[model samples]
Target: MSDKAKIAVDAMGGDHAPQMVIEGLAAARVLYPGVRFVIFGDENVLRPMLASFPELDAASDLVHTDEVVTSDCKPSQALRRSRQSSMGLALQAVKDGEADVAVSAGNTGALMALAKFILRTMPGIERPALVAPVPTLRGESVMLDLGANVECDTRNLVEFAVMGAAYARTVLGLSRPTVALLNVGVEELKGKETLREAADILKQASHIPMEFVGFTEGDAIGAGAVDVVVADGFTGNIALKTAEGTARFMGELLRRAFGSSLLAKIGYLFARRGLRQLREHLDPNNHNGGVFLGLNGLVVKSHGGASAEGFKTAVITAIDMVEADLIRLISADLPDVPGHEEEAGAA
Candidate 1:
């Protein structure tokens, strides 16, 4: 209830729960000394793990819960039966004002379903969109609808634009970020009707604090042509996976090239420093959090297979969202919708 951040954690979720979760919480405590945590999971398991990290234990309160939402459980199934589960209880803490944000590494679908059902969408926001930062040539760009809604209309895209831009400003420190719709080409005549319509609306909107950079092609995403990229969940998810694969492919090729011969090995020794820097820059662990934007309360989804470092990145990302007061910024900037003005104001 205080201004200081209180993170609700689903300690039972993820590939390596309890241990990994505790390690990440320890790391986050070092980075954010004032942050507190409410851990939800089986007391027997988490207590032993907590003993290993006394610092984190001193900063956290453990809540007992044996039920867990499995990685493969259907979203509806989780919604129906996971009320007392670790993941569900963590979200409930946020809904009950016991936590500022909820962080989980559970099933993506179940997390989305449960979070939406618990927190609901903010006024004027139809559905919550998943967003994250992707490394780009210029720096990093914010991309939205990573895998939330497979299909989206113009209104959805416009809403994504607003939310993504606000997120960029809050997390990335951009004052007036540039936003563009993802399309086949930069031409105004290219791509689907939804992209065109969203572009048209964003370009004309006067309330939002963003520059409509028109349209950007998929190739421009890594080039950092804009601060925000708007796409339907299907396309965005595909692009995200493809980019991840390409990065890995390039890394493997580099390794093979360096291991091919004695001369290459010598070259690697000389270039190893630069390569290490590049590897760290491209490591997914440093960018492991994806946010569910437009929810009444914040919920961050960490990669299920994330390492302690990766989970630490997620916790930091959640703290950043709280520090930025993301919900207030979104509520203030969301474009006015017909008949929803009063609701939005109240939000």
Candidate 2:
């Protein structure tokens, strides 16, 4: 444990919980041998899984807990029960300085709610935003506020830009990322007052001189002209799901076309490898994970539909983020945010 990057994982937090998590962690261990994990969940069930793979004990340490935080449980209930819940325990490990990062695929709402309460937002943060990488025409692009805070104000949007820019710079290795406001249109008079206000703020904000390239429509996201797209969680979530559905739809349609006749089959035979690569490039399953930013500590969220591969991906993301010291970089760029600043004379 002392020899690796420690990450606290909720063993029973996903849809397939112990089964998928253990499998994914096992596979990931091959690629990331130096990464250590702290598993938190019902020892009774998880212990048997660990026994099935003798290698499990060698890979991770189990922070045993009996209670499980279900997807339907209220945030408050989960937090109250967290004293003994797996997700709670995993998170507590990070708060206690025992782990460098935390990962979970449990109830996103509850997870975000509890994270805000327990970890608290950064000094300049108004609300924590969900940030994820999306497939793009050029390569990949980053987007933010993907359902963490469904409702947001202008100030919150500005903070999202600051954080997103920082993440793009530090994690994505963009020197000065081209930031864009996810809006209905590109013209200056396109969106509502809310977007207008947010756009204006990004234009003048010096926290990070992100290339604030104005608005971007749904179609433009795939073009990849922008590095980060900032929007309210409600809008961002809708766009994300819509993009996933469209990618799947296109794949099926192409497959159906290629399977039509002997002539079509021959063409597909030669193009099969490229087609598969294209499908993989666009598959949401490949990147079905994200991080909740703006908090003092690192917290990542995995898709509920995630397999072991997806869970492993989330863990890998959290490890890189913690190692890069991303939050500290963002803090260096923000204004005197409400929660970020220290009290003057102890208030």
Best by lDDT: 1
lDDT (Cα, 0-100) at 301 in candidate 2: 90
Q: What is the TM-score of each candidate against the true structure?
A: 0.96, 0.92
Residue range 1-347, candidate 2, lDDT tens digits: 32378888988887888898888778777777888889998888888888876675677898777788887998778767665678877777888888888899999888887788778887757699999999998788899989988888888887898889888875578888999888889998998788898887778764464788889998888888799999999999999989888988988998899999999999999999999899889866577668889887899898887988888778777777877788888877774334333631232
How high is the lDDT of residue 135 in model 1? 88
RMSD of 1: 1.8
lDDT of 1 by residue, 184-249 (tens): 999999999989988877777766777888898889899988999989999999999999899999
Which portions of model 1 miss their true places by more than 4 Å?
A: 1-3, 336-347
TM-score of 1: 0.96
Top of the candidates by TM-score: 1
- Any residue pairs clashing in model 1, and if so which? none
- Assess each prediction's global lDDT (C-alpha) against the native: 0.90, 0.82
